[model samples]
Target: MIFQNRSRCRENKSIFRAGNQVLQHTHEYTYLGLKLSSTGNFNLAVNELKAKAMRVFYMIKNTIRHEIPIQTWLKILQAIIEPIALYGSEIWGPLKTQDFSKWKKEAIETLHTQICKSILKVNRATPNNSCRAELGQHPLLINIQKRAVKFYQHLKRSDPSSYQAEALRCQEQNRPRSTLSQLMLKLQPDQHSTIWPNQIIQLQKLNDITYWKDATKSQKKMELYLNLKRDYKPAEYLSCVKEHKVRKTLTRYRLSAHCLAVERGRHRQRWQPRERDCVCVCVCVCVCVCVCVCVCVCVCERERERVSECPLSGCRERTAPAEVAAERERLCVCVCVCVCVCVCVCVCVCVCV
Candidate 1:
């Protein structure tokens, strides 16, 4: 593949000969699963990664029940989806956060938030910040940054005479925006380091690279989780959930794969109204009819008492007719009241069941 501007690339006739055969020109190609584009950017690779991750995510989503614990879902995402999305990020991940690169970061963040919202069974309208806050998940860009750094560290620790180490040296000297240089600039040998955007953590001992990496990551995760809790308002669904129970469940699951998925499922179902109009209508109608019958009986007994206490001798003879008229009037009122009550109950159940 040729790396050039559109006009120049179109003008140039690119060909290659291997053995006795000639190779055709191509604008882009995939090497070791990374797509190299003539456009001189990893945009295509990032997009493909995002697409692949989403495809895997959908397959998981369809195959597994949403009733899975939040922690399990998170593990699935980190183990499966994130690996796909962050594949080869070591090469392209550390580009200075610019237009397309920044957008790619946001895109990955969006995917992470989407998965979080799904796991929590929250609405699509839930704010992304709140979603991340609720789940205690750091922005995915941070992971990409870490991957890039670890790869840089691996190269530095590798054989100096090796091709990869030599390339790293060349990039460090020539390319300021290269992954190695970027990691050097961000993670200087200091008391602390800034791994990604807005994240700062102490790195008192860089000699022990593995230990330092793990310590910094844990500290950053805790700090971010706390900051989010203190700053952002919880999602509507989250706010309605029992705070203590949620925290306990999340903590338990994070510590170990606990079988407390049903707790969250219960909370979600509580907030989610199931609108079965036929069932609600039947229930409300039965209730209203029973209530109205009780009221009608009371009214009819009162009418009978009034008729029996009549001062006229003909009142006794007229009791049957009077009772019939009163019964008719009361039945009309009872039916009207029952209908009104049933309609109101039905609407309430439909909206807030």
Candidate 2:
């Protein structure tokens, strides 16, 4: 009985161990499957995060590369972080959700730390001197600094509360407003005068002269003429004018000249070659010549082949003589026609003369 009880207890323990092992294996498999299913999403998230970080880094590098102003760098940083903060609540979801709050807090903290560190890094990286001193110097930074100073000054004047405190604090700390302004004030103007003494004397003399009275009289006469011109309507006034004999003479001369030009242009246009007709004639001539040449070649080739293959020797000889005679008769007819056309042209020319 004691052996059986011990055996039973051992069996129960062994079963429990096996069951636990199976459960462990099942849990591991499930976890692994879940991870595999979400792997693509996880990788995408990581890639996006890395890309954002790279973009921010590159932006900072470029800003520094151009020797952009510290204010500009600050503005860039602010712009980057502002949206993140503004959308944090929506992005993180409700605070009641454990996953959201925890993730949001962690992300915000990490970003905040990164931005603060980046700001310090950028400030340290910027050059103390002018851009010309270094290769690949940033002009954007210089412009940003100038704009920032202007903005600060404007704010100081327009709204003391917006800028006075900051300026006073900066002054107390003995900070320089800008390097350019300091350098400009330190620079001395060239001693040489741009204008000569004689020119100055001439300008003074001209200034002393009173030409206004004569100028005023001429201006009044001009104004009166313009008023008379404006008051006269072209169609109505021309009809009303009684002494238009001189105008009529001028009008007749202009009309005759215009009519002569119009007639000359009309004659010229009538004689000019029509482009479309010329193109059509050229195309027709080319097509006719090509067709005739092809027909002549084909006929000559067939005649030669027929002569070569002729079983009867007298047949080629008889046909050749007849063909030659016919060709001679055709040429004679063409020559006679050309001579007749020349004779007719000469007779017509003699009659006209």
Candidate 3:
């Protein structure tokens, strides 16, 4: 038989009996300085964070009376306000927005926009997206996704059977429709083809903040260096990597002249008795090496003369002043080497024979 209304066993009014006292359930409670709702929503906590961020922003504005560099503000945001406002956000954000209630959804969106505006010093007239671009900051939504991705990368390499891993596995399998689940499913395949490695972002542990910051700075510097090198003219690169063209030509010419002299002496002694001939295995090797070097000298010198006007050799990119200087230097070297090699060879041949 069903219980009557008079039974006073209503779900809302239900009480539990302890050994000597009664315990009651409530809709809200405070845990670890954050409000916890019975329905497990964090709207109140987000609101509190937003208010605190506003207060901190004002405090920073008042503390600095002079025209301080943006770097100082950046350090404060990074060191204090950001951490305080985003303390527990990593737990809930970067997931599907559909899973959150309307209040939380609105609160998160507003929180990100307001925080961005405050930090970037942009008035309401300027577009938030443009402000983010100007400051080289990611959108609020993407920031959350970044954190989630960083955490996901860490958990992926952990022991599969451990508590955190098991929980994540379960969540992944059950929450396929979540924003993070769908995002990874869509992007994981593309990650293999990307230059960035999957494990590079696993710097999400508590103690890795300093390491991560330093690593980011280094990566940016490396990227800048690579870009500079890539766009630099081939002429500059040649100078950096190879010996001076004049020096190379001079060395080759000297060796070639010595070889020519030895060959010519052997030729002149050909009419004499075979026993008197100075030609030997060493002479033959020297002649061959001289011939090969002479041929190379001619070829390289001719190519440089032919392409003297083209600093890039074949490309159409405009040459820089440094590249022009480098080209002129190489040209001078090639001319000197070619002239030395040719004159020495002919003179040695005439003199020795």
| Model 3 poorest 10 in a row by lDDT | 229-238
**TM-score computed on alpha carbons, candidate 2:** 0.18
lDDT by residue for model 1 (120-144), tens: 6555644444456565565665666
Q: Where is model 1 more than 4 Å wrong at Cα?
A: 8-11, 96-105, 175-179, 189-353
Could you tell which candidate, 1 or 2, scores higher by lDDT? Answer: 1
For model 2, the superposed segments whose C-alpha errors exceed 4 Å read 1-54, 84-89, 93-105, 122-353
* lDDT digits (tens) for residues 1-353 of candidate 2: 01122232232222224554732211111221121111212222323343565466567676664444434545665576433332322211221122211332344334443453343332221221111111111112222223333433344356546566565456536535433233222221232434333443344333222222223235422332233332211223223434445433433232221234442354354553567656655565555556556655655665566556555545655555565556646655655565555556555544433
Off by over 4 Å in 3: 1-14, 96-109, 115-122, 177-180, 189-353
Model 1, residue 218: C-alpha shift (Å): 28
Q: Is candidate 1 or candidate 3 better by lDDT?
A: 1
Quality of model 2 by C-alpha lDDT: 0.37
Ordered by lDDT, highest first, the candidates read: 1, 3, 2
Tell me the number of clashing residue pairs for each predicted model.
Answer: 0, 4, 0
Pick out the ten consecutive residues of candidate 2 with the lowest summed lDDT.
Answer: 128-137
lDDT of 3 at 7: 30
